[model samples]
Target: MDTSASPLSQEDFEEIARAAARTNESVRLEFLDGKIREKAVPDGYHGRIIEWLTKVCLQARPELWLYGDQGLHVEAYRRGNARPDGCLARSGAFEGAGEWASTEDVEMVVEVTSRDRDTNQRDRVDKSAAYAAAAIPVYLLVDRGNQSVKVHSEPEGGRYAKVNEVAFGKSVSLPEPVGFELDTAPLLGWVG
Candidate 1:
């Protein structure tokens, strides 16, 4: 309910997010600092990046599913649920069609940074460590404000060993859970 609590109850935040996600038409909800926040999707810029990512990944790996602005909960950490801009997950016989991704289910997570440096920092710093701790490989940050993208990989003991930053005109590829690459020029073009 408040933003000052530690290890906030997932049930509380999840219920709030679930309600907001169902009713709010323009924004998606996620919990941070024990409070639920709504995030607006930038259609031309951020949405385009999600579209391109989905198109490319689905074309190469038809069995894999790509989702944008979807909620993922790492129950083990009581971090509540986080809504990444885009995410990739491999399919399996045991996985269902409408289930949330478990720690082992997610492959890659991407976040497109807005003008807010706080958001950029949160995505790049806090969630980066959270993903590593959850053992999710390949965390990508699309930083439109700086005309750059950052790729984090090689997770070892709750942190990444390498972080590769690519500029707007450059191309970058993910290293694990499936090697996927993209050109940054097209994705960052809509920023302006």
Candidate 2:
């Protein structure tokens, strides 16, 4: 079905997204790189991973909160909308901000891979690029598919200039704005 004359247009996508949000509570919709896609409803393992990460982030930086399923306006010029698994920012950063908040105050965005065919393109590639283009300080990808954690930082020219990947049992440090080291050993249990 032709959703719009130009499906890539943000205006058209937002209209459709609003309608979808009203009609469907079972799935989340995202607009990235000119395509609208459904984000998988996270499973139990996904919830555990996010819970663990939230605890870790809070313990390390009490001033910031890891908000789950926070909608954000991503990509250059805020042309795309994404509901990341977690959004870390100073507490109340999004207070009073309606759905699809700007990325300005977001210190980091996290995506824990879902057990679905779209995980690779949706999480590892598309979301990473969208977050970088929005100039978000850090993008943390808990990649269950590869049994690894990928940290994307130092955005430049609509892409991350630095990427660090470590196996689930290893420790990885999130950069400056999101200064913290994650002991990914706990992650191993959350992934199949």
Q: TM-score: which candidate is best?
A: 2
The 0-to-1 C-alpha lDDT of every candidate, in the order given, reads 0.70, 0.89
Query: In model 2, where is the ten-residue run with the lowest total lDDT?
Result: 1-10
Candidate 2 lDDT:
0.89
Error of 2 at 82 (Å): 0.7
Task: Put down candidate 2 lDDT per residue, 138-175, tens digits, no spaces.
Answer: 99999998999999999988899999999999999999
Superposition error at 77 for model 1 (Å): 4.1
TM-score of every candidate: 0.83, 0.94
Q: After TM-score superposition, what is the CA distance of residue 152 in candidate 1 from its true location, in Å?
A: 0.6
**Model 1 C-alpha lDDT versus the unseen true structure:** 0.70
Clashing pairs in 2: none
